[model samples]
Target: MATSVSVAGFHKPLYSTTFHGGWGTSICGDNSTVLIKSVPEAVRVVKPVRFLPVMKNINEGKGLFAPVVVLARNIIGKKRFNQLRGKAIALHSQVITEFCKSIGADAKQRQGLIRLAKKNGERLGFLA
Candidate 1:
């Protein structure tokens, strides 16, 4: 897993005015106020958003493959199963990519492998 850190800052001036004899006097004379706010505290809020997907390991073979089997069983008839079977490998690889991403797999590498799986399925005529 990889952690990405970032920092940001914002600054604004606080101003005030004062009245003097026969005139409005800018007593502060545009005193420059400097606020050096450390951004380390911000990581707590942002870490979850960026790493939400990798919190738990997604066991692809056990978690996802079982559901595919259950769904394959529920199809109405042989014809439907046959049709679904033709698409099974490609669909399996797509789901695996999602599972990999959830379990901290590098996005670019995982996607490239998934594309290869899809292309293989297509070459084998499993996908038209």
Candidate 2:
């Protein structure tokens, strides 16, 4: 079961009269308020879970099999991390084993690739 749940939405704020005739004067602007339900209330809404290979790659490297790293890398502001978006899936354990078998990367080289991918995510603020 998921641990955290929340529902948030934006609503316009109410305004009181101090109305001025000029277009320059009004009580309301672009202001909005966010409403969030309590955790239990939010949990009542069942959300679908998605499983993606990219998420698996990031999660496994970080030790949890969680997939948020893919999304974070896309927004991490580094060209290298951005380049890793869809490309990181090639680093998955299954994929890596296949590639290493094909190219004969030694155990040391295999470990290096794992570290490199994990380090890349951590440096981009995605792993944490």
- Per-model tally of clashing residue pairs: 0, 3
* Predicted structure 1: lDDT: 0.51
lDDT of 1 at 88: 73
Candidate 2: minimum summed lDDT over ten consecutive residues — where? 27-36
The residue-level lDDT of candidate 2 at 92 comes to 77
**How do the residues 18-71 of candidate 2 rate in per-residue lDDT, one tens digit apiece?**
433322122233221111232357565578887675543343445332346545
Q: What lDDT score belongs to each candidate, Candidate 1 first?
A: 0.51, 0.53
Quote model 2's TM-score: 0.29
True-vs-predicted CA distance for residue 35, candidate 1, Å = 68
Report the lDDT of model 1 for residue 102. 88
lDDT of 1 by residue, 1-128 (tens): 33333324322223325323211112223332211122355543544454455543233224325455545556566578666676876678778888887888887878788788756544443332
Where does candidate 1 stray beyond 4 Å?
Answer: 1-91, 98-104
Q: Report the Cα lDDT for residue 12, model 1.
A: 23
